[model samples]
Target chain A: MDSYASTRLTRIRTAMKDQGLGGLLVCANGMRRDHVRYVTNLNVLGSWAIAVLGPERGPALFIEDPWDLDRARRDSWAESVTAGPGLLDGIVRAAGELGLRGPVGVAGMELMEAGLVLALRERLAPLTLQPATRLLVELRLLKDEGELRAIRRASELADAGYEVFLGTARAGLPEYELVAEIEGFLRDAGAEDNMMILASGGVEVTGMRPPTSKRLQVGDLVTAELTPQVNGYYAQICRTLVIGEPSAAQQQSFEIFWQAQEAAMESARPGVTISQVAEAQNEVFRKAGFGEYVSKRYTRARGHGLGLHFDDEPLIWEGNDLRLQAGMVLIAHPNTYLPLAGYMVLGDPLVITDGGCERLTKTERRLFAVAP
Target chain B: MKRGLVEWDRQELPEGAFAARLAACRAGMCEERLDALLVYTDVWRAGHVRFLSHYLPYWSSGLLVLPLEGEPLLLSTQPQRVFPWIAETSLLREVRAAPALGKAAAAVLAERGWRRAGVVELQELPWGIYADLTAEAPGACELVDASALMRGVRLSEDGHEEALLTKAAAMAAAPLAALDPVGQRDWAVIATLERAYRRAGAEDLMLLVTSPTAGQWPGVPREAVLADGVLLQASLEYKGHWLQLSRTWLPAGASPLRGLYDRLGRAYAELSETARPGLSEAEAAGLLKRLAPGDGLHLFAAHASGSAPFTPLPGLDGIEEGMVVALHLGAEDRQGHRALVGDTFLARREGLARVTT
Candidate 1:
């Protein structure tokens, strides 16, 4: 529960040793560099690095870009460090520094283009270039306490933003104003940077999209799916609220959706098949004659993992074959549209627990009615 | 803006270039023996869509019904009775009302009486379509990942595309260099880039701003302080074009940092000179790393293009002639000192041309 970088690195090194690999090459730039920060604690803006592990050397960080060297070393979990450019050459140099030559297992080596692969092989002709896939992403599928905290913080920010909307948003208010308020609040609150899109559900059907200057109309469903990234961890919190008095059909739709969400959440637990959670939720809708409507209109998974990436996997869907594991943070929503009702959505963030799941989002998951 | 690169311009892709790419799509589909090649265009672009359709949809989503046989139709889901966006694109046959978008794809296909097809851009195609397309179609419409075709076509940037990126990089770099350090150790560079993007007429903006200090963040903007000699890698996204650039500012008089910076500048040029055309990216990356100073000196190893804060490059990139790249070169020590010099260039046979210049 005491999340530490070195401890994970040890587990990773053990995996590397089992694979008989010398080093794992990881690249980062722009937004995708979350993995680097997750590992080394250094955000290499425009750099590439390969983390090498030899039986004798333990672990080392070989980075190319100069800007992050001091920071990478200062922040890195590993003590063995070197800076240089050519990936294979840098790895080779790190390999040489550790006196590891003959055969070194490489993770990103197989991902190289045919030409680059040939060139690398030619350069390190005698050394064995074993194939190893990038396993760092999979390692992140499950979250520890520290990771959960970051996600929880992100979810709390989303909750605050929702509360702000609930208090301020109303019919006749332009969509962008609501969007701007949420983004401005998040930025000021010092949350992990954010990029999100919003949709004002008046336009026939609206998926979460960038806020236009579209004014909210009476009976409009204002849907907002905003993901504010926290140190590379992404939390997708989507909430739909009625602008004014909802139509009877719309209110009815919300009730059915509210029940479906409950069924799904109650079924989701550690070791449970993701499919079971999905089925349970769909069953609630199925009994209500909304089963066929869900399939036709509800086009996304019931829930997905929130932290690290948009990794809504071990996906809770009909055919999804992934099992939920403890500490896995997920967002669940049961949303669909019947011809009579325009749209319906119910969302909540949950953490997989020992027996079942813990609801992370404290928001009232229902049709948040707003008076114009 | 940095050391080299002063000349820059956005030379638009030729009028016929879009048509040619579409023709290439048709040819590719025929070769793959796939039915129809479904392409997409949207605001949250993957960047490859513009290479073929020539129309950059500024809305949430757009779809291209690129049949191996007929003229491609650009189905925009921006809710218009009239296709107002048709003027910007070279794509013909615009369908305005996609009332039931998920179901429309199959209806359109059935109306055309098409059976086998390949869908490109899997990321944009939602799960609903995956279910609808398979269920509604008469038989399995042999969907292939048309994205590979996109990657293959995008092996190198054309001269016109090169020009756009160059202008973006050059225009983006100047203001950043001239920027005064704000009060905080951390400042928002992406916000500044957006201002620069508007100054340079960039239709959409997505740039990377990274600082060694505590404040810089990715995608969205964040505040970070820029001390003397902090090397910032600012990858500018403009008018849907991407440009990679880096600069080191030595606030007036910082000698050792400046000296180390000068050394890196020389090394970058030297690396450029030696970077042969068609050099495998790994070879080119290796060449750059080998030049990185030994003990007393330091530098960022390097990646292929300056277009960062992140990329999917297995390493840097294979340096090819006529291809544009940002060779990142910078160094910082434990003293909170950093200097960076990055130049965008077009690889030539023996030498490289600084595209921004």
Candidate 2:
């Protein structure tokens, strides 16, 4: 096995032993696939998959789609790979074969199908099943060299995507079409996936969303959060641009968001709580007299972690006391609605270092302008 | 997940279309003796809710509460700040920002005094949501699995659905038709298709590329250069509708799989010809066996398409009018020669019509 896989396996087995778990069942679908990918190194497609890892034996991978069997065998590092017309049956058989006699930990128990969980509980008999999602999260919280490399590549792609966005944003261009151009560019540039949301308007716009049919007009403020994933690692860059020469109010709004994002990024270092980072950003907004927008009423998170999953842990929000550590990667975006210029987004992806955080995104932190 | 163009085009799917869908769902609820129906939706599975409310969730999850009498309500996990956008894009007039979907849905049931709530695809509902729903609800409220009921209601396509499927099929096929895999890397080929699909406004895509030299099984396209004997499978969603198309490409030079490709083509023709209304999935498999016989063929998937919860063939139901089906057939010989062909088809009253032509 590769060193990466070996290290990960050792960590997982140690964790399992600590919890007195005989086995770890990691469940994943197209949406919640980070845990399974972390274990098996197979990017799951189709409905769902389960990775059965026991302390004594190598992991066994079971996928829902039969057509994906050959690929799973070829791609996954699991000792045995199985696919199904009957996925639950395969998972149960594999679990039994692995000799999981004690309580087993399931990483994605809450996301699994209700009937599947009930059936597993009934079939597994006295072997208890425990929720272990937090365990996986804790294990993946730190970034390794290989993961950081992939995130860095994804950050480069995100920058390229924004360049395309800037070039494509013009008057009479529909928001969806503009997004289409950016997506095409990113995909061609080797991005496996991109989670992007954009909006174009002025004071009427509340926040960014999936591309709409609305056409961009002169002086419109177009904000986009472009997150591109490469090799299962996602990096995000949120920026706002104007179709024409920006008004004084738009530039003023942009300053607030830029300052807030800078503050948040500056506060993001090892030993600092995520809440502190969020408060740092919110404090800027409060000082600017737009403190009301800091709540959930006007925004979601000041920033959040980005990794295998687009939205990972350490969500930079109030009440989240998770402390930042070296090797943790996150995006500090003070994205919210500003009554002066509608909504603005200014953020950059960064990795917390031993002393401080280093910004991964090299895009200039300013409101870009395009000719009408 | 689906970060592509997600706007609801009223011209394509008008408010009346959603009204008709909601009406049909309410009619189904009445037939099932359900006081309300709850459809769970996330980024991966948003079809049922999208069909009823034109609300395709971009992230997180949500619950659609359709009472037997009143207009349907959408409880989204997205922040309230985006509720105005959801309301503007969807037919839902009532969009609540409920991070805890089950608790909110239970409250809705309690407020409506619903006694029997049918949860579509109840088995697939996340355990947390299911547990919360059952725990927080009134003591007398009953939740039953209504997967089959929703499937039965959605099995047949309406005019708007058929139109969307047709457009999606064309969009999926155009890029493949224009692809030239010779001497090109797999990633480049995928990039070409991705560019085309996104340019055409595909909401989502699932693409796989396979070659004999690279591997026998279709996998996510990688950076290996392609030579001959390539298979491309593209399944894309456009405007909430899905269509799949698979094609095999061979160089003009002599290849061992030439004859096999011809045979696969003939087999696909026979399968499409025999796929008529009322033909059971078992019957379809039987006909496939008759066409290929012995170990000459391998069936990948033959199933209903055009929406979520794509029911595979050899299922409980037969081919029905207005149902779109995707059939994929593959063949391989001892010498490692292989060929595969597949397409999406629409079942009409008269016969089957290929949608991915």
* Top of the candidates by lDDT: 2
Error of 1 at B302 (Å): 11
Model 1 C-alpha lDDT per residue in residues B200-309, reported as the tens digit of each score: 44433434444433422222234455543344555555434555666655556645566666766777777767765666777765765676554133322222332222
Q: Quote the lDDT for B154 in model 1.
A: 57
What is the C-alpha DockQ of each candidate? Answer: 0.08, 0.66
Query: What local lDDT does model 2 show for residue A200?
Result: 88
Docking category for candidate 1?
incorrect
- Candidate 2 per-residue C-alpha lDDT over A254-365 given as tens digits, one digit per residue, 9 for 90 to 100: 9998889888877888999999999999999999999999998889888888898999987889888998999999998989998999988988899999999999989999
Evaluated at residue B235, the lDDT of candidate 1 is 55
Candidate 1 yields a Cα-based lDDT of 0.58
TM-score of 2: 0.96
After best superposition, candidate 2 residue A182: deviation in angstroms?
Answer: 1.7
TM-scores, one per candidate: 0.63, 0.96
